[model samples]
Target: MGATGTMNDAWLTLREVRAGDRVAVLSPSWAAPAHYPQVHEQAMDRLRERLGLEPVEFPTTRRTTTPRERAADVNAAFADPSIRAILSTIGGDDQITMTPYLDARPVRADPKPFLGFSDNTNLLSWLAYHRVPAVHGGSTQISIGPGPAPHPLHLDSLRLALSGGDHVLEVPTQISEVGHRWDHPRALTDRPESYPAEPWSWAGPSRAVTGRLWGGCLEILSWVLAVGRFVRPVEEYQGGVLLLETSEELPSPHEVYRMLRLLGERGLLAAFDALVWGRPIVDDERMVPDPVVASRARAAYREQVLRAVAEYHEDMVVVQDVDCGHTLPQHLLPFGEQITVDGVNQRVTAHFRRAPRP
Candidate 1:
């Protein structure tokens, strides 16, 4: 199950951050901060107060800019010795365009934890290709700004990501698919409405599987695979753990199936020993307001996922509806670190390693 001459051959651990260290908060994709300055400011405050880290912004951090400009900012953050970590303001649809402009030298020379999700998968995958381990979730806008405070689980995992330690992923009792619009005043002070989360559904043998992590938002990953620049050979993923989640854009169940089917066709799906499917955001109060319809949609998503898994790798351990991805109370999974999926006890333990000084 070892890979050679591929991204998995040598994974670099990121240097952990300390309190009062400077962290670059950039807009590598959409400048959500530009449109919602108040929310962004609130998120900055929380970053300092909760994590004790000073937030620093680059030129494009709060403004819409070209992909090249965004990539320049990211490069600058990585090149700077004072910046211990980097966080994206939010994710957007066009981060894939930033790939060509990104300078891998800076990231490889000084690997610091880069935390983000959704379209930031573009950056995460690029970092992974260069052997730098990153974090898969932790958008400042969605994770820290909108809620009354950062969700405890999110904050805890984020803290561990920045520092260093082992964390057992917890299944949240309640989850929210939608939050108040940043334009709404209550978005600043109130927690989003939530409902009881469905218990995680497990499929496969009652055995434990441990491996390095790969994968991200399913739609963005499809784009990554199509682009074919950041992805490695399918064999590179053998015995690795695959993480998949959908966004609020809500691709249909058939689309989900097609994506997995494409992966299967590419020999990607069967390469992993286990898969962790994040809980999908099925209900949008303003869109699909009917709870019954939302429930059915959720079930259909699970069915399609299992359908694909069975087709590709029947013995692969799968645990769906875990609190990750588009849902609130998300857990920031380490993108290239070792994680254990114990199907017998149904627990996920993430092993976060502290980087050795270069």
Candidate 2:
């Protein structure tokens, strides 16, 4: 379906974020990575300096164990009429713990752009349950990291998420191929060797298929599944564009396949019309042993996804490496916005029919 109603699938007509918007920042679930503090400060600076939006930070922005406290902050942010949006500094591990405490009534009454990736999947999936569409990418720390500013893809998606549009985001032609030790003493200046960008590949038809974009960090989703907190659960996701990426934790290929198999078991894999797999974030310190282990990871993922589709979904199309999550130059995805995937033509485009930029 292209689009049926203004508030129906994808909800194309609403502008979730605006210029001069006041956003409250909170630590939705897990604590930020070691470099997170610097990343957070700099990212907020960019939003104010470049985007001209005001960011409000809650006391739990750095707290992970305090799920209730974090949930309270979210409640405050959503209930505050002055704050137009709520942005997670970045994703954490156990945000699903906050779901029981969230007052979904106020959120549904006035939905705003809630952005984050990785562990923040908790909020995105939770909001989706309440019919509050969230923008699935862009975190104050990761998206606006200390690199050369918002990596182009990072900026493009964030702008689109905050502003909305019909546009193409360029993948990183040159990529940060390695990871840094954030908690280590010498993280500020230690940069990794750069890797050249390869064009994105596809495994589906060239014609475009529009659907409300869904899915998030794969591990996060697994956790959400473990906690039984999907929006409407597996069946509600039929005909959606499913996007997934792995974190720096570097779960093994076996672990990845196991998770996919579990989703397959849940009848989730067969539900989506299309699948977009992000380039797994490969980190050295994670002791993954293989710097370019992405190849193995890709092979394993393909096998699992294909198995799930073969068993459950035959017509399902797949797209790999569209560049979202854990990777540098992260792109913002509309959690419930309509997106058109042009796989066969060797291009993937996301179109938005939102209000004009502020």
Candidate 3:
């Protein structure tokens, strides 16, 4: 490993989902759409019935209206000694607004595993700032909900994340081409549309490198950058694995370029040794658009966006189309931890500096 961050900030690994342990489930921000409760329940059942972990819910877990209430629920969860870990019901677009009032003391004292993605980035970034290793995927609504079956890629990535391991997180190649619906009543049954699986393939891996991992949904990360939290020094990230992915909003290639350009302008782009950029979720805004147009847009992502970042950070090895973000079978990446990016092998793997027992 290259330079590691201060051990002053720490990670508290929670036990994997066990039949009787109480795990806190709360809504970080927005309440998922109406039918999402069933989706959430189904997800809980999967963990309980299959993995044998109890899915505990907090009072504000399903509320749609108050940010303070949501934050309070999170604080209470952290304060409760009965709760061993914290998990998100799903990500919301404005989780940032809700987290401003969060009390960091309990989290710092216990430091148990926290998992979520998308808008959940707000919380994760805060944890990273405090030096807590937060897992960046595994929302109950999507990954565990009404999919035809548990996505192998999602399961494997999540399993490793929850169980803690000396393992390399692999991206699944064959993925569902279609995205799921949040509105259809029957969708609560997990009847998501299926598309052909598109497996992850590596592009440019220059060499093998490892260091503390940091990042989240690209859009959410931009928010963190905009808000100006306690971002780590650029020097703290040299030769480290930097993870990134776009959200369902599907930012245009131009937007992607501008964001990366700003990162570079701030002297932030040149710091990473390797970068993993996830595939943009094409099902929502881009779904109705022409396939030809979408292909062109994707092409623009590879050429315009990825290539532009490469231009500024000339030595950085970048990997594209990784199965993360709003895509199917998402894998959770731990922020403020060590990961190995192999350019030669075209794989990006995450390892724990301190792993929890299964």
Candidate 4:
């Protein structure tokens, strides 16, 4: 794929990840490996066994490190030629703090495919700021740690994006809203219950909308919005698909409405050609234990999302109930690659850049 017309930057080429390659593991936000050694080791073992990739930890991978130190780890990963890719252990609350400590020069010079999500949005935004396209989903502790295996959809998407191929994303037939508690002994052995999957609900125009996918966890976006860091001018996002999902905190419907309202107020909502809202996960076991109550919560979340779209850009193509967020069976979304939201056909397709290996 050629450079996107909407934004101008020195586009960095990301090489496909190869088997047996050394992948640098870093924690820019939370150091899950530090607190849960057993869980961390299990996840690392899975990566090696299933993907045939060896994970090499940096300073911040195992324990909590200063923001500057974490940023240094990221810098070193990209600058080092031996490390084929960079992966995050997990997400936390304040990754934006690490941005100031990051040096963009080396990152721009030797861009490698960085895979992460949630608070990792800050790093994703930073990479995009330097014209580097990154894989926006996947984490060692969450996406790959729990359960006996990574969800089939998650594994497929990860392979496509990392190995370099165009992938038309499909909604999973089954979805899991809850996760096993890491501290619990049954966490590794127990799997989250799966629910009947829902089809993507399309709103607005019936015509197709295509653009480079952007955006990340909405809560994280709000944090970035507050600092006014890493984000470019509103005009640059003209032809982008806004990919948004709420975190496990499960913000109320009113909060979701208000956040989207804030985006609209800033003239940010109307710029995107299309929007993909991930299926919100109702994972709080204590808060909403009753299945009926949880269902109501999910419905309310959807209604609020629809209201926000109607208020901001009525003509914009929007797809809701997508399986790309905090929910189990997460699919990787390329941060700056082309995606097509077919409203008429009720489908979304991701076109990964088939670039030759560097």
Candidate 5:
């Protein structure tokens, strides 16, 4: 299944953010806000103080919400003329069930920036299919909530995306893979310790590939694949940059390989021009608690994923250890927007908003 064409130019223009713009916050998946009101409120404060964006909560933004209720908030937010963007409280495990309740007409008629990752990937995929470009990284609880201030890179990428202009992003020089537990008192006042970043690893030819970017947590992607909900034809994804990352759940190398192989078998893996593999975390309390073991575990996860990808796409360009998913200093990237992967120079630049369509 060769790519049908390039989506790099197919960006769906959405409304721009301005001073006093209202952004809707919805818990489309988990009720993290409900369970962790302190963390949620702190994020809202940052939204107002940091970005000057007013945070508006939906009926289901907090409280033990149902899938239908969550979907309603999403539809309602997009329908509201005042809402400039939609942000998720955090990622959960069962967003696949909420999609059926979503009405695409409002979102399509008035597309706005939708920001999240992991389980929120379901919503991002739906928006992409409707030609609504969405930010595929960032979350209220993690990237925006826990830190004393948002990571500089995350703040910079988000500002550019909301500013409604084209911007080039460089990889973060530092990242924090560890953080205080959400329940810990320091979660609000403290910031995580940071470590120097390893340069992104590039595989395949020393060439460049540019296209619209898609994909999220690999585990949720498997769910999307099995459910056959938003998994479009391989042709629809031709020449797109596939973004994949793991979660704190920390799946084994075998599991990673299995999922990648499944995608390859379906011809999905071959549809993308390149892959941006997020840095895998190995600090799960239950899995690799020892920092030394964690590093080894992450390396094994990378090896397994690369092996599976190579089996299907020998010439496909791949960039590993990108500070995008389940890691600190995450960059909020737009799905279905143009991105250039300079395999030759080991650079990846995502065009948040494309040039005027000819």
Candidate 6:
């Protein structure tokens, strides 16, 4: 495996998947599949019926195991030639713990597309640090299983990630931050209620900026930065487009600002020419139950994010409230591939081709 920051020109090769290609579905973080077998099964069924791909599960896919054990499953998945791609059952809090146990040899030897977000950001960052490209969002448990069917926007992006192509992202008119309880029988048949989605907010210059994509769930990224193993030299991120989103955990806007402030202090903030902020889940409806409060919280998050960015580079291109991350109808981003953030035209284009080697 190449040293951190040394393999800037080479990115993981992403092969287009055929209809019957086998995809490893692993729970590298929490075993949500074990807890909600019904939901997991439905997600698997959709993976077959909707995507026409076979879902392969490892011994630990539905079981909560030690970090090393989880790493072993990830390693086995990557080393298996039959597995064309890897998908997470869901994201959890401790994926960062499993990172050190992952062996880079298989990942470097056979780089396949891995789709996940939230806590899965740990693995995504690990892959990026090792020069292995993957997708930023696609939780089988969240995106596929919970609702009546997969979100159209998510399905489109997942197809693009698996089949390989350039796609301009579509913004959904309605979005949902919370879904029905997994244990509820209605979760399988009913669609979660959604509200009118705010149009994506763009700031800075009107010109377009294009670069390779980086960043993920802000909380998980804080853990990644603290561990310092997955991060390359700050210069390695120069000109890359930063992708950021908060999870359903709904950290305060101050917390969001602090995380970005830390990135600025580390010189990581200024390295990116553009930043794409995923639509944030302001408050859990179950907890707050007030749309007005959720609306205000969302605004504060946007304010803090912009304040942090202004502190470092006020002219940096910033696009917020994108339909990615914790929000329902999420779009998967090509983690280590090129993306064009067109502020002038207000569009985001993702390039899905295998990155060239130097």
Residue-pair clashes per candidate: 0, 3, 11, 0, 0, 0
The per-residue C-alpha lDDT of model 3 at residue 345 equals: 78
Candidate 3: list runs displaced more than 4 Å: 1-19, 33-35, 171-173, 183-191, 197-205, 285-295, 353-358
* Model 3 lDDT tens row, 6-37: 42234454344434667887788667734366
Candidate 6 lDDT for residue 333? 92
Candidate 4 C-alpha lDDT tens digits along 1-358: 2334465345667777888988998898999989887778888888898889999999779978789889899989988989988889889998998999888887777667899999998988888877888988889888777777777788888878777877777878777776677887766766677766767777888989888778899999999888987777787788689999999888889999999999998877899979999888776564224567656777898889889888988888988878888887888888877788999888888776645664
Of 4 and 6, the candidate ahead on lDDT is 6
Task: Please report the TM-score between candidate 6 and the true structure.
Answer: 0.96
Q: Candidate 6 has which clashing residue pairs, if any?
A: none
Off by over 4 Å in 4: 1-5, 8-10, 286-291
Off by over 4 Å in 5: 1-11, 286-291, 354-358
| The best candidate in terms of lDDT | 1
Candidate 6, residues 1-358, lDDT tens digits: the string is: 4454532477767777778889999999999989999999999999999999999999999888999999999999999989989999889898888888899998888788999999999999999988888999898998899868988888999998888898899889888878888999978988788777778889998989989899999998999999999888888898889999998888889989999999999998899999999989876666223667667777898899999999998888999989888878888899988899999999999988753322
State in Å the error of residue 170, model 1.
1.0
- The local distance difference test score of each candidate is 0.88, 0.69, 0.71, 0.82, 0.81, 0.88
Provide TM-scores for the models.
Answer: 0.96, 0.86, 0.88, 0.94, 0.93, 0.96
Error of 1 at 83 (Å): 0.3
Which pairs clash inside model 4? none
Q: By summed lDDT, which 10 consecutive residues of candidate 6 come out lowest?
A: 1-10
Task: Please state the error at residue 65 of candidate 3 in Å.
Answer: 3.1
Better of 2 and 3 by TM-score: 3
Off by over 4 Å in 6: 1-8, 287-290, 354-358
